[model samples]
Target: MDRRRLTARALAELADVTVVSLSQIKTGKQVPQETTVQRIAGALDYPVAFFHGADVDTLPAAAVSFRSLSSVTQRERKAAIAAGGIAYLVADWLHSKYTLPSPKLIDAGAERDPATAARALRQAWGLGEKPISNLIKLLEAKGIRVFSLAENTKNVDAFSCWRNDEPYIFLNTFKTTERSRFDAAHELGHLILHKHGGSNQGPQAESEANSFASSFLMPRADVLSEMPRVQSLQQILRGKKRWGVSAAALTYRLHKIGLITDWQYRNFNIQLRTDYGSSEPDSMQRETSTLWKMVLDDLWDQKLTRADIATGLNIPHGELENLLFGLTAASDRPPLRNDRPALSVV
Candidate 1:
């Protein structure tokens, strides 16, 4: 029901069963017959074997750091959580085949401020105030599994959560590249600053994540050295490209760091609102997953296609594609030799 976003009545109707029967089965009050299980699986487009598999771990709604929690509907939230469950299966499959990087994130929940936390993470990672060339690659190298969210809606920008000592981030590729980068950084903040608990903190968590993203993407020293005085919107537009952030974000960062006065900040914000209400101008190219590209390429060498992966996971091919959409370097690129050990499973 969660995977298909179906209610009991809807699922029962599709499966040619009564709602009471479905509810009883769901509540463990009655056992479902083999024919009933087959009908339910058929209705949900999942294999019968999928229903018999061991129980899968599911992400709790309170644990997921949703960018816009208030705007997300219950159905949408369920679907997103279901997607995370599927992502766990995919990650497990990858782990069984190849060795992956270990989690390198630090717990920053005790930090006094988001900026300080961001800087600490940067120093720990040995980034040294340099503009990250590819934020997605950086996250993956740090053992953060990055997946694309197929929601394709503005309500769900991105989300992140930790499962079994590993971090996972899901990005909504429907937004501009600049926004997506910020979203990635924002989720990173949640992972470190609120690792134990913060998703339920509401506005406070979101605000800290935003500040962390701004500081992480555009370091205080780097922004000061690059653009000390922002006189006009054009300066912001030109400077934003270096940090891969939106003009509004750059303006806010400048104001926060005292590089720009409150009056100037207000004026610039008004101008930005007039020009680009909810969209970014001159956005950069979206970042793809280098780790996923390498994984797919390695699998390709063993004559395993994406369809094979979906079948192995007992999921639809489209579901796997949705999680990986726009994440690979190319769809038809030839396989390359991988340095990792050979797959343990065919």
Candidate 2:
């Protein structure tokens, strides 16, 4: 069998065989029974026939894929829902412009096992020390289709397609501001790493995505330069322009990369809570959202109304109106929901 991915324990459990028996199979000393093939196939999310007599060369290094999250669990579902509308919008936009390559479908649940995936992603993006901003633009430039789908929009924060050795990216509109940023980076992680099978990302995927988000959104060099020797909101605010992060987020970023002391971080969090409870900080404000405004305006110019967009994306027309009116109203919310969008025409 190919060395795709299978812990000895996981294979044993799936094959319904003893650990010793599973070891023998790995060593090519013995073959398993049909029943064992069934169990292992189910566990690996693969077909039983393949287990019996599949070529190792046909298998990939790892089995990685993402599907629209089905569980109604709030957070997971919300992620899909949030990304659904936006993904539709993005995909449609790409369809209208360039003849994008077919996108590879992905699971929305690859946050698990993100470490190895993260490294693979970094290599793919040709990114290292720099932070990633304007992820939508980056994806578009890569010729991957972006679209919107309202009906089946699973609280999707974002998704990546891996097809023909290329990747495309998508984001959901149902998330919060910070969450959206993180989602874009997360999907970017999938585009770079992972395989094409089931959408299940174990643990390493999550770690890799998180790492990509941190490095992509907040480059380490920028974080170091901005870390205040003396804790001051004013200093932090000044740093935001170059770093392109909110004060609170920047504060956390400082601590994340070991720029700030733990004592300083704790005190800073308290200070921020006291200063800007439930309201965004002045430092967090930006003249424009580089990607958000650009994409929205471009789509609007292409003769796509928010209402028309909603229909194409399978979202409620009224909901589309709400988002355009600067009033995001919906039962399901993404982790990073945004009330502010680009300029709307009519």
Q: What TM-score does each of the candidates earn? A: 0.92, 0.50
Give the TM-score (vs. native) of candidate 2: 0.50
Clashes of each: 0, 54
Best-fitting candidate, scored by lDDT = 1
lDDT (0 to 1) per candidate: 0.86, 0.50
What tens-digit string does per-residue lDDT give for candidate 1 at 1-346? 8878898899999999999999998788999999999999999998888888877788977789899988988888888889989988888988888778889998898445999999999999999898988999999889999988788678888999988889999988888888899999999999998886445248998999998999999999999999987888999999988999889889989999999998999999999889988789888887887887777877767677787787888887777877885533254456544445243342
Task: Write one digit per residue (lDDT tens) for candidate 2, span 261-291.
Answer: 8998898778878987855565322121233
Poorly placed runs, candidate 2 (over 4 Å): 1-97, 100-133, 144-178, 196-204, 226-230, 283-346
Worst 10 residues of 1 by lDDT: 337-346
